[model samples]
Target chain A: MTVPAAAAAGYSLLVLAAVVAPAVVLESAGDRGGVRGAVGADLIGVSAAVGVPAAVLAWRGVRRTTRAGRSRTDVWIAASCGLVTVAVAASALPTVVLHATTGLPVLDADAGWPVPALWAVCLGAAVVAGEASRRGVLRWLAG
Target chain B: MPALNRRQFLAASLGAVGSVAAGTGLGSQLWPLMGREDLVPGRTPELVLPAGAWSPAADRLTFAAVGDTGSGGRQAMAVADRMARGYQDSPYGLVTHLGDLCYYGSVEDRFDDVFTRPMRPLIDAGVAFELAIGNHDGALHHSDASLAEIDAELRLLGTPARHYTTSHGPVDFFYLDSSTPGLFGDDASVQLEWLDDALASSTNQWKVVCMHHPVYSSGAHGSTPGADELLEPLLADRRVDLVLSGHDHHYERTHPVDGVTYVVSGGGCKTTPVRPGRFTAAASSTLQYLHVDVVGDRLTGRSVRADGRVVDRFELRAREGR
Candidate 1:
């Protein structure tokens, strides 16, 4: 409901993603077992790398909005964004599991996760940056 | 407190929708498992050309073998055109794309006009193509998908004789898919059996194997540890005459290993620095293709650069069993 609360949740989700996603991929890699799996796990790790930064931004944005009495709208936006971050990280869980458990590349078995991860990162960055910039500008203009 | 202002409510609603949309649709798509078609055009995966039928030369067959030329933009195009003109001057049998069909292995999005249109001459001239998958053909900053894409393309290429033995004249050719899981375990077991049977029973004079990953490489990607451990012994044991690969993005020919000549001609799309005078008898980093001349019992192979110069040459002596 509040900006701070939403921001905290976003960051928490980010940390969770960074820690858990790679573990799953590595485990998956071990099970499948090979260079292919290693590459697959690596993809999970890459997603985490991107996801962590996104989570941090979402949190900071929410915090700033709530503090500025923009919580009526910014809080909800931040919450929704936070959920998106978690979902993106979660969707990669199977791949992380595959690479972490098996030692095979996740994409080897007829499916892959890299394309979706790429698209997500681009869209996430755009949204976060757009909101953050817009809010900052509005605040400045008001002053 | 005063009731919420309409403008504030409107702005907030817009931000919420924007954030959610950004987070869901775009972020979901970024999942890494997304297909080739999902990638934005001209980003990572590039769209090359649509599929078409091609015919090989009846005699004096020639084709371009290129690798690592996927990213040079203008330079790559120039090289491709030169090869195309060469194809025109003396019609090439086919264009054997070594690998890294696109840089960073981004698939559909990575293709550009330079790659698609510049090689038009070759495509239009009816030069059949054999493309292998490269490391860069996979993922970026993440797991590589290029190998999978290569496999998909291979199947898509409609070469129904998946991993078959064929002849162009005096030369016998064997095309293989040597990617990870396939090259190892059960798949390897089956293919190896097929290879041994084919090599033992074939009537052709010269035998050669083609694949995407290399059993020996000295380029940026270097040798695949898995390949050496699993596949090299097969080559040596079979006394296979020649092995051609593409992942390294350079051209190299080696002294016969167990009576087999290992050639790395990965310069199809881009060029990277290569380790010199190591295992190779001859090597180059230029955009080049291999032209094999099969005349009766003697098969001569030349590495021709994009500029139309024959850069390297070797001969495969015919064996008696066939």
Candidate 2:
């Protein structure tokens, strides 16, 4: 499940924000629980949709590409995949666990399975983009 | 009836055959390399540096800068702790880690014991544990999330000021971040611009540029020609004083080029062999760090070991009042 670059970047940013947001809230909130919780929940939702797929795609992509062979392209792809994987995992983790422990459905109908849908779209886009970028780079080099 | 039955059976059979072929193809491709790729573990958080802190006075400052020290577990911790104990002053300013704080650029619970827990004292102090991200620090493959998270964590830890200059006294320190793997594009232009600004802005008697990779080295990583070509001339133009780095895990000092000294105090984690390069003034493969002291215009710098013995010392005249 390779993730597209734009989506991956978005996920990376969101994950970092989620982790840092807590600290920021702690710094500024002065003990506002409701607001912090709302922000935290939103961050979790974003992570679930973008972050999980990005990570899954990256890990699988790296594993598949590396095992396939050791071309420079493969290595680069593998790395890209791995990076997305880490980002996805880091961002989605806290909320996923929290939801599960609280007996809340991991996939709620209100969210309309957005994470799964985004996974499909981003993964498709990533494959197309990766190939296109690779070819473009090669073509430019040849010229 | 007979024609319709034949068409339906044929179409269903074709679909089943295609599905089987696809499943088999996927299995054949994915099954073989599972052990090698899946089982090979990422970096485990081992003690790279021991737990302790140190402080240098208003007249003299003591600190350690190290890079590529994310591995070696207990051995790394032992060396770091020994160094920490060596500078067991009442208040230690902090450790300036060049980068590669966590191996594979991801967080691990195991690393807390090895990396974070021990350095709590330093965090407690006003000591600035400055860090710059490394090529490996951003992510294992291409993930920037880990990098962002690390940056976020560091910021929360009160080290948010990336690529800023500070002065203990007469020593003006310029901290810069080199390019990471997928992001920042490996161009030194932005860092160089900041560096140029930092140097031009500073009237501080001594200027020190500290980064992760060595612009000059004879170690395993070798010399970064791009850095030398791009950065050296700028430093020369600015009449900068000292350049410090820690990419290769060894200690090295270069002859003053363009009136600037280059020191590689990389012996923070692992040990690599030292071969003399064109600019090397003193080179050591042993674990060591630099202790810099400033008194008025006379700036004194020393490279000390884990055992607390001075390896190299030099003096540079203050830039202006001299």
Candidate 3:
């Protein structure tokens, strides 16, 4: 059996948080300054929602305007799916940021407890916020 | 689902089994070739070094290091015996000792009972002992007996040279004479040039520099006088994996600076207080020695006390990302 659409989206949001939060922390590299703090505050605001609401609204907006594909030769149909795929892949920008800026291991016993603790906190928020947004979006679509 | 004939079902089952086996084999082989990606970061398990009471396999290069073991007393014997235990558990090839072979301020007279006697097990097992000059290795002064004394000590220890390089498995160890004038004074140009050239020319996957004085430490005798000015940048620029040193009389591992981890394992025979600096990852004033294992592109080490407790564990990955 397939997972419920809303549940899948919520899980995807939680997964996004799992990726983005550690990237932000590692990018800070134990030297969090004013700029990083600002970035974090902004991140917290975005991560708390997981972006499911916006993605849902965007997907609905496209589906409303575009004609549905009737055959395998539908190029526009593929373009619309590609847009969603790009958005899904973009959720993993955190690991990319970490790889570009630093080389710290994903887990090291010497990195102290703060890092892993932060990762856990991010996951917790992702669960709560992701589920809440997922339900809210489903309720809105039904209305 | 649609029903199938017996021959069609058997054909499908065989195809499924073949696909699963091929996928599993391909994944196992391709995982190593996959470098760090923007999506998934590469990670490997942390090893506790051989001193964690585990033995290294024959494929990897393994070694141990102890410093300030010149007293030739009970503490030294304990350390030497513990080293022998580690060797018996898994025989490593070499012990890179930095200095103070004899606390009597002489190496020739007590070469046997003081040095050889304590390490007899490892010696008999044909494990090589590489030496780097420490303060009391008879290089204290250029006295008439100094040259002969140093020569006799090296000859006895089977390490007939100073400031040389040795390769084992995938690692290259460059032993340096970290003494005063030999490393920094006017006559130091030759050794420095040789080290820089050697580091540049080395083709080993992991490069380690061994010396008597550390380039960075938080112990009583801290870094060697001119190490930062003369040696620190050289090792960092050359991309050395690890720097091993003694003389601090304690075990301290530094936070990597410029991708190089500096370790001070000086608790061989004596204990001294060490304060952890901002750059210090771990520090302890206990009698201990360091055990290192170099496998593939990673180096793992643990500073283990004579009681078999691991005081610190750290690892360094080759910058090549292999």
Candidate 4:
């Protein structure tokens, strides 16, 4: 399915927002229910918070890129870059650092949602952004 | 491809590799270390709280117990507000938390929001906060970080150790770290030994054991394994009068089992459905706390909701020999 270029750019920005939103939340208040592992509810909330702004930013960013004579392929590539960067960072950093520091890649029950959820969210955001930033999208943001 | 497109393609390829790694289960196993694990603090402190002055024979001991209150939401605030109101009315000197004080595995930065902020009223009034470590508070998992989380919680709340004894007037409280799966099978478990000795040596008229997991519960988390086998004999042998616990997200008081009453008061912030078991004296799926009064030879416990309603009440006389 083709997504408007503007929408694609906005969705990519959401990759950043999805991570930021929860960081702000954890920074502000870090309490979850009894369920172990990633909190599905938190992911839903993050999606809503990031999705709205993503929509707006997609409109603006794609428009700006189109006006500057860029193609839908460019937007897709940019989103693809962002997604990959976040995913790789999310996957590799903790294990490498934890193993180096603590002599173990200690994935205990206490890590819970904050760590994994952040990565899952970024991966999810990337996937969505990648899909939304389609190369064959309509020229809605075309100038 | 242009230099910029080349960079983008390189990133896309890297992400694809990551996806493959994850699919092949290499990254999947490493998912638990998702964030900057180094940033997770491990500095533990020696923070044993000094016991306040109170003579059990002459003075009465009053306090409140709550659990599962780490949400820091309207429900937690409501309970705190009620606790404040309760304090205003009767002025309790201490508030004991049954664990899970910080939910969602909150980092140290959230201590204020998950704990101090909501219980501000009680804290400001000089009411001491004592915590029993919960599963969510870094006790369920086994890792260096988990130990650090336990330390962080201990330091935050000023608990003596994983398990230790503290006094409040005539009542001597023995707190246990029951968050791990096996009550007695902890890698190098000494909690039971400590409890046994602590209970035997107490001079107070009341011996109340506080823990995050229940000794006898019928709620979501039933009785802890080895609780009856390993811990029960000690309590019954020592005439330990009460076992206070929170983990089930509801309120349940058991019928006296071998002269010891087990109570689960886990409805500090949230509630889930709970049906009474045969041993249950009183049970309810409600948001509430337990107000307990310990006088000379009698202890009174009242299950109170945020609306000032007393859902359940029971009285226990001092153990005959103790």
DockQ scores for all predicted structures: 0.06, 0.02, 0.02, 0.13
The TM-score each candidate achieves on chain A is 0.44, 0.35, 0.29, 0.36
Off by over 4 Å in 3: A1-143, B1-59, B139-141
Worst 10-residue lDDT window, candidate 1 chain B: B35-44
**Better candidate number, 1 or 4, judged by DockQ:** 4
10 residues in a row with least lDDT, candidate 2 chain A: A26-35
In terms of docking quality, how is candidate 4 classified?
A: incorrect
- Candidate 3, overall lDDT? 0.61
Give the clash count for each candidate.
77, 16, 0, 5
Candidate 1 lDDT over residue span B1-322, tens digit each: 4453555556556556755674565345533232111111111222233333224433334455665556523335445755655554555566666656655334454343324544665665555666554445453222335445554545544444436666664556677656555455455788778887877776666677777777877777787777776778777776677788887767888877767788898765445557865677887765667776655566688887655677788887765544
Q: Label model 2 with its docking quality class.
A: incorrect
On DockQ, who's better, 1 or 2? Answer: 1
Best by DockQ: 4
- lDDT accuracy of residue A28 in candidate 2: 24
lDDT of 2 at A117: 41
For each candidate in turn, the TM-score is 0.52, 0.53, 0.56, 0.59
lDDT of 3 by residue, B114-196 (tens): 57656766766667888887866766554657667767767877775768898877888898877766676777889999999
- Model 3 chain B TM at 0.79
* Candidate number with the higher DockQ (2 or 4): 4
Q: Report every candidate's CA lDDT.
A: 0.55, 0.52, 0.61, 0.64
Interface root-mean-square deviation, candidate 2: 22.3
Q: List the residue pairs that clash in candidate 3.
A: none
